[model samples]
Target: MSQIVAAIDLRVVQLEKQGVTGMALANQMMGHMADLQMIYNTASDRDLRKLCQRFPGFGRYAMLMEEVSEQNQTMAMSGTHPYGDLPDLPEPLKTALVHVLRAAADLERDFQATADDGRGDNQGRLTTARWRWADDLEKLIYQFQSAELPLQTQALVQQIIKATAERIGRMG
Candidate 1:
């Protein structure tokens, strides 16, 4: 399970790096984003930890992964960061931001759906997932506007924001 989780995470990192490097969006781009959220859910908990004594090998790596995950969470929360230093990009490249934003939204929805059902899931995981999505969305909006992003990118961002707002409106 951990190995599969690691593979998904690596794919997410690769996609992110590829986008930053101005790679063309391939057919698997959307599927890759969905897989990332799925992996996050899979590796995030350890109900079996309390059942067994330390399995030495798994214990060590789990601890290491937990720490790495914490650091990534921290970076995601710190609003003024990560992709801030990117150079001015063309319409095609900047449009890729939509994928990042959509992935965040998908993660939030996935977590919230589980959390709301109260199906013996960890509340902390759900709360943190939602917070991460909200914080990252805000940061993405700031970064998108701060840069001289192309008109097409601006339009895409606007559409996402509008759609999200409408969804929220319906809930109320």
Candidate 2:
């Protein structure tokens, strides 16, 4: 997974070389990514449910749900943001993002398992683990989003963001 994150980071480097600085592409990616982090930080199932109301397409955000369902606990919480494009990120960054997603997925699993264990003992550790993973992901996302790529690349990123926002904005 770390390798994947490294690969994605490299891709960002490559994109920078190709010219993708100052564009909203990085920012847009960060926004959706931040939403994922927020969801993982959610403290209650009810909150998760409320969050889901905005993007009914949550089932598509499978990075973390698989493990949760396996534990037989339903999400009572909701989160903002839907799954959008994650294309073009380098392997390391991409892998890191995926790992973040996986961690979220694993968190759901832990949440459910704790419920079943009924010991209430795992809650503290699970919560700590989830937060730890989320924090790291947040740092990486911030690093990528704030990165200053080449000037031409920046313009291209802005163009892509404008086009994408326009497209998705219509649906919203």
Candidate 3:
């Protein structure tokens, strides 16, 4: 198990060093992400210490991922960010992603930029971002539904959507 994890760590590092980007990096990480999510889901609290021991950066890495996921949910509920996490996602979902991002950017430039008071303070910001979030959900659902995802992956994606939407709805 140690050797296997060491190999995975080495491979990911090597890939990072190779400067993979955009759709390519997304495609590669999809497998690892799926597997990691599966293991993470199944891990008992008692198993956590062993997992951290097995993966040198597991704790910090997982925390950061959770933080990012939370931030994404916050953005969906609150407002459009000036910058996107990634301007693009990998196909076969890129088409939908690009369209939604463009729409959000257009809103930011046209309405958010011109607001006398800061747009962030206004409900318009939340409205615009939610528009994009709606697009985000639609596209992602299509992507997930169409993909040959494992059961664990499908469940995880569903959980993410359901949780984020539920939280955002509660804020309204």
- C-alpha TM-score for every candidate: 0.37, 0.35, 0.35
Ranking by TM-score: 1, 2, 3
CA lDDT, every prediction? Answer: 0.47, 0.45, 0.51
RMSD of each: 14.1, 18.5, 17.7
10 residues in a row with least lDDT, candidate 2:
77-86
Task: State candidate 2's TM-score.
Answer: 0.35
| Candidate 1: tens digits of C-alpha lDDT, residues 1-172 | 4543343344333434445212222222232444444544654345336311233323333344455456657776785445434445556444545555455445534443454566746556655755665676677677768768656657755675656544433322
Look at candidate 2 and tell me the lDDT of residue 62: 24
List where candidate 1 sits over 4 angstroms from the true fold. Answer: 1-99, 105-109, 112-120, 164-172
Output the lDDT of residue 70, model 2.
36
Predicted structure with the largest lDDT when compared to the true one: 3
Question: Model 3, range 19-128, lDDT digits (tens) per residue?
Answer: 74444433333324444565577777667567666665444344445666677688866767433333333565545544443343333223323343444464666677
Cand. 2 Cα-lDDT:
0.45
> Which ten residues in a row are the worst by lDDT in model 3?
104-113
